[model samples]
Target: MVLQRMGSVKVASATLVAALAVVFALTLMKGTYSFGGFWSTEAHRNRSIDLQLFDAWSNPTLWYAPWLDAVGNVALFIPFGFLLVTIVAGRWRIPIVFSTLLGFLVSVGIEVAQYVYAIGYTDVDDVVCNTVGAFLGACFARILGYRGRGFVVTLFLVGALCVLAEMVLSVVF
Candidate 1:
């Protein structure tokens, strides 16, 4: 019975992982130049992060409409890492270091696609943010068992709490 349960989990995980990989691959391959209706113009370069249009990072408040952009980027890749740890084979559970590498590879691939297909620029900031988001997702799986309902959901909530807590910390302490 125990073995059968594990086998089911393995199968389910594998299927989920395969599906995620395919979606990710296709998304990366397809270059949509008019994504978000905001990235259409290349004139946002003058909006500096440090000096000109700074937001209260400590507050976790949205700086312009870009807060949605950041959240969107972070939320987009959560499933990749989740699928990695959950469905990957026994010896192939994605390690943190490997996850980071995967993030970098994905970021690179996206940037390359954008450049080759004339969709987006090769921004270093995007790479850093993406890698961080992926890691957070993978770390969620690692700390939690990665397969199951109760604990996995708890992990996701806790992870969000941590991110929120960080912002709260910035303000409180």
Candidate 2:
């Protein structure tokens, strides 16, 4: 039993590192990360920030694009949450809380890097969605019985249904 747990931990750690590397490559090197022309005007031109919370929903013209982006952000951090919780804790309570907190901190770090390096839009919306994603991922890990809930699953189901309803409404009305 001890050896099995140790092996699992090692696997989780490796997978977590790989997942984070992919995340960094996707986010940090998104728009621009030129080494030679780091301070060029062109790099600064692409840099933008959106501080208004859920501002995307305000524009009807944006329609499904913003919603899709929100889902994508959540999906992106799900693996991080899952792996981190698996590696860090054997119980559900601490893993859920810490995974969410770490997710928020990591998302904030990514946003800060985006702002400084001018990689992409530093939007608070991403932070919010990413945090939620991490929380959900931790909950999902608990559900798989690998660590040892219906609550989070039900909540996510409801939320997903609501999103679907809104999408249909937007198209019909």
Candidate 3:
């Protein structure tokens, strides 16, 4: 019975990871999947990379766009970090560090892809924010005792169901 339950959890975790990967890809591509060719590469080649740190503090504005963007970037990776840590809980000696590094690499890859595809500009600030978010998520997962396979499976199911419901509702309404 225990072996059967573990197998089920593994299956669920794999499914959740696949779903997360799809979502991440769609998000990084801005929901526009293409196979013909990369669009507007030359036009965006001259775009300047912004390495400025603490942009919100450097230019304090009432609009709050920068702040919101920073927060959004962080929020975007939290679930990814949480899920990653939960999936690799028992196997990894330092799951939090692994999660943070994974987040950094993913963020870097996205930034590079954006620059290459001309879909968006690259920013170091985003990498920092995303890493922090992943770290926080890993910490949260540890606090919640997600080392157990049962808890991880339950969490994934609940999250997946919620996301599905949200998508359905958005389409219906």
Candidate 4:
């Protein structure tokens, strides 16, 4: 019975991971889904990288922009870390570090793609925000306790709730 439950948890974890991948792709590469060529033919591309960390604060009128973007980026990857830790069996540090590194690499890749495809501009702030988000997410997973049947169940429930919230928000807006 225990083995059967574990197997089911593993299956659920895999499914959640797959769903995450799809959501991530859709969210990041939304511009690619438009009816256009493979590469954007825009004459101008934003390749400049803004190293100014607090520049987002300079705009007094849009004060919330920076805060929102940072928080949103972090919130975006929390699930990635949580789900990753739940699925992988290892020390807490392993998943935490792995998730952080993965988040950074993925963010960098997305920035590069955005620049190359002329879909969006690359920003160092985004990379920093994403990494921090992933780190927090990993910490959250650790807080929930790592690598157990209960943890797996909790992860699935939390993920489902998050998905439901997202769906509700999308429908409302």
Candidate 5:
């Protein structure tokens, strides 16, 4: 009974950590809401500026030089993937289907938030890429968790790495 209780607590903690990570990312990028949640719009530059992927992809300059830009965008949402896995599987044990759906919701939420806010724009590619990023991170966490890893620890570590990386990008680039 004690062990079961401890496990449950760990799972809950893991999910909370992931949620907080997402909030933190939002806070750092954009000036959030009046009530204190990380405002996704804080990261937006223009209200409805469309970053069409086809246009971006067509540019040869973006192909190799902006690796950091791509990483920054994708890494920004790893926590969502991490959190979805933790929530559905209880310790990073989520199945592919569950991860996919949750990833989709999160990506959609982000895109919608961007559309609503005057700063950010709604882009389908952002949604697709963000979901893919989260999915990859979740898969990594799930694999490690199978060997008795604690989801909470994974959550904290992943969040920390992302935070640090973003800081570097913001400072240097």
Candidate 6:
């Protein structure tokens, strides 16, 4: 029994790390990186931020862009929350609190990086969507109880799909 529990923790931790890697890769390295260019005057001119919540949805010319961004941002963090709950499974309150805080912090970190690196827009909507997604995932995990390896495997599958989607989008656009 102890061995099984240990194994579950290991699997959850590994899945969490992989999920986070995917998040960073998709967030930080989405666009081609050019450090010198980022520091150049021309590159810095394009940097943008939207502090107002849900501002992305108001784009008149690009109605679908905001929806896609919101869904993708939320989906990206779901697995993180699920795996986090699994890692600390059996505890009711700790898992929820841990996942929520960690997920929010992670989202904020990514947003800050996006601004500093100028790789993408720094939108408050993304943070809100991500935190909500994480919280939802944690709730699901708590409700479903610890399914152990199954959840980890599912997370991997989801991560793969996300990566594939990203690749296709990059190639197409």
TM per prediction = 0.54, 0.71, 0.67, 0.65, 0.60, 0.77
Model 4: how far residue 170 lies from native, Å:
8.5
Worst 10 residues of 1 by lDDT: 45-54
Off by over 4 Å in 1: 1-62, 146-173
Q: Alpha-carbon error at 81 in model 3, in Å?
A: 1.4
**Model 1 Cα lDDT, one tens digit per residue, 119-169:** 434455566667777777667667766345234433443454454444345
**TM-score result, candidate 2:** 0.71
Model with the higher lDDT, candidate 1 or 5:
5
Clashing pairs in 3: none
Ranking by TM-score: 6, 2, 3, 4, 5, 1
For 64-173, candidate 6 gives per-residue lDDT tens digits of 76777789888888888887888787655588889989999999998898898786688899899999889988887777765444644454646656765665565456
The local distance difference test score of model 6 is 0.73
In model 3, which runs have C-alpha deviations exceeding 4 angstroms?
1-12, 15-19, 22-27, 31-48, 60-62, 147-173
Report the lDDT tens digits of candidate 5 across residue range 1-173: 43233234455355556455554455334543322222233445555645576345556453653454456556655655654554567434436557667667866776666566554556666666766777775776576553333544454556566654665465455
- Candidate 1's error at 69, in angstroms? 2.2
After superposition, the stretches of candidate 2 with alpha carbons farther than 4 Å from their true spots are: 1-7, 32-45, 60-62, 91-93, 147-173
Identify the candidate with maximal lDDT. Answer: 6
Question: Least lDDT summed over 10 consecutive residues: which range in candidate 2?
Answer: 32-41
Residues 67-107 of candidate 2 have per-residue lDDT tens digits of 77789899978877877777776654588899999999999
* Reference-based lDDT, each prediction: 0.51, 0.69, 0.65, 0.61, 0.54, 0.73
Q: How many angstroms is residue 126 displaced in model 3 relative to the true structure, after the best TM-score fit? A: 0.6
RMSD of each: 11.1, 11.5, 6.6, 6.7, 7.0, 6.2
